[model samples]
Target chain A: MKVFVTVGSMLPFDRLVCAMDAWAKEHSEAEVFAQVGETSLCPANMEYSAMISPSEYRDHFAACDVVVSHVGMGTIITASEFCKPLVMLPRRAELKELTNNHQFETAKWLEGRPGIRIIYSDGELAEAISKSIGSDGGSIVETGTRGKLINTLRQFISN
Target chain B: MKKILAVASAGGHWTEMMLLKEIFDGHDVAFVCTMEMYRSEVAPNRFYAIPGVSRLYKRSIAVSVAKLLFILVREKPDVVITTGSAPGLLAIFFSKMLGARTVWIDSIASIEQLSLSGRMAKKFADLWITQWPHLADPVDGPTYQGSVL
Candidate 1:
């Protein structure tokens, strides 16, 4: 099985790295590809790795059996759009990565909502990834909402 | 057929509210938020900027009270929905006093933990909501609607 892990711009990558190492140690037969930081963490071997660009994100999602990510709106939606089963871990504010703790907020909101899965802990995340190997998971909502979310803004402004 | 003003601090709050954009499809809706680069980037319609307040006041409560009054009088919304920081809490309190229904939705980020704004807004708002089911009732009238966004 091939897994793709894309964590958004959050600091202290050790948590994800630890999860990946543990998963790899458990399933020595699986191939894992991941990118920890953009313009930061150096490339290392699991299967494929790079500090990828936005243009390359879809390809990365498509190539993987499972998607692991941070609790980011764009990342979450994109993972769903591609029908990639997603496992998310929120960056803790106590870790000093964000000004306030909001990722967990996003995680909790997206959890059990159609095609997403929220993993609050590293152990849960590893387990979710393990399940993805056999399970047909993930949700896809209807598109063309760009006009709708925008219209809501326009109407709110006009009113 | 009531006019609802759903106010947030922009960024995550605004984005979260936007998820429910369909609910306001026909209702009269207004948005109030703070002015920061992140807030401006989201570009809310009919946006009102509030002075960001600290947890502890340097001046008197009267001043904050006055600003709160001014906002209530200006918006005159029938209902106020907020996911607060500081400005959002003030909106909830004053909006309620003016006979508007105030619903404070705590940010969804703190699944288990209570945010500072959630704690403060709980005391004065008509309804307090949390994304987490375990937060209990923050106020006598509060309800946890799970996560709206």
Candidate 2:
């Protein structure tokens, strides 16, 4: 149905945006929206924006059926909060895409989490998107815990 | 009710702070972060944005520290917590000066060791938690608390 792809706020992730565009073209029925960051490649198949304001950012994620993002913590946490299925593409330091390889480390650490699919390359993104949409974001996330983490927070604050 | 101040510089730092959302839900929570085109997780009244420290350049941290100085005075929170970057460090620094308890939960992305900000937080944070088991050093104030990821 609806897909939102975010490459995060700082770097260019044209590889992801381009792959997602190809995926959307194949799907035909899926609606794709992307926050492309400072990338040069423009997508002709999907709705694209360089960046969005705070309210619009949340609204887009909330409305999307699935969130495809770089392995940045911001994107992952936001996707988890919306209970949206996620396709995380880790940026590689060897490729000069990021300052370091921490995103690769994050993907390694997050391997078994529910409803999350980690793609090492653009080739894997289409399948993850297909799987996410097919399951209606049910593969990685099950029950939404709106207040689950807050309880721990309140306890920490009182002490 | 106790008031809390949450500060994270954005990206992984902000994400880590938000993963602890339970702590801020009902409290008089206020947040400070790097400038972004995104909205706050909480209400607008509870959020502040300052320039993020450029990891490549040390100058940005000083600017944000100056901005955070005033907010710390105004909020006068009972406690301050962050999943850190330089902004979080500055917030904690000021919070400590203002007599607020401070907590630092290092980012999970630091698989090998504590981040630069996490290391800086050691002298200030009342409690320091690490997501990775290997990074925990109880004597140094960083303890294993499982993961927020």
Among the numbered candidates, top DockQ falls to 2
TM agreement with the true structure for every prediction: 0.51, 0.80
What C-alpha lDDT, on a 0 to 100 scale, does residue A116 get in candidate 1?
63
lDDT of 1 by residue, A1-159 (tens): 887777653344557766776677677777777766533444344643434544466677777778877776656656656778777788777766555767867676676765566777787876677666655545533444345434433343344
- Pick out the ten consecutive residues of candidate 2 chain A with the lowest summed lDDT: A137-146
Docking class of 1: incorrect
The 10-residue segment with the lowest total lDDT in model 1 chain B: B34-43
On a 0 to 100 scale, what is the lDDT of residue A67 in model 2? 89
Q: Give Cα distance to truth, residue A111, candidate 2, Å.
A: 3.0
Best by lDDT: 2
Pairs of residues at least 3 apart in sequence or in different chains that clash in candidate 2: A54-B37, A54-B38, A54-B39, A114-A140, A115-A139, A115-A140, A149-B22, A150-B22, A153-B23
The DockQ for candidate 1, computed on C-alphas, is 0.08
lDDT of 1 at A78: 63
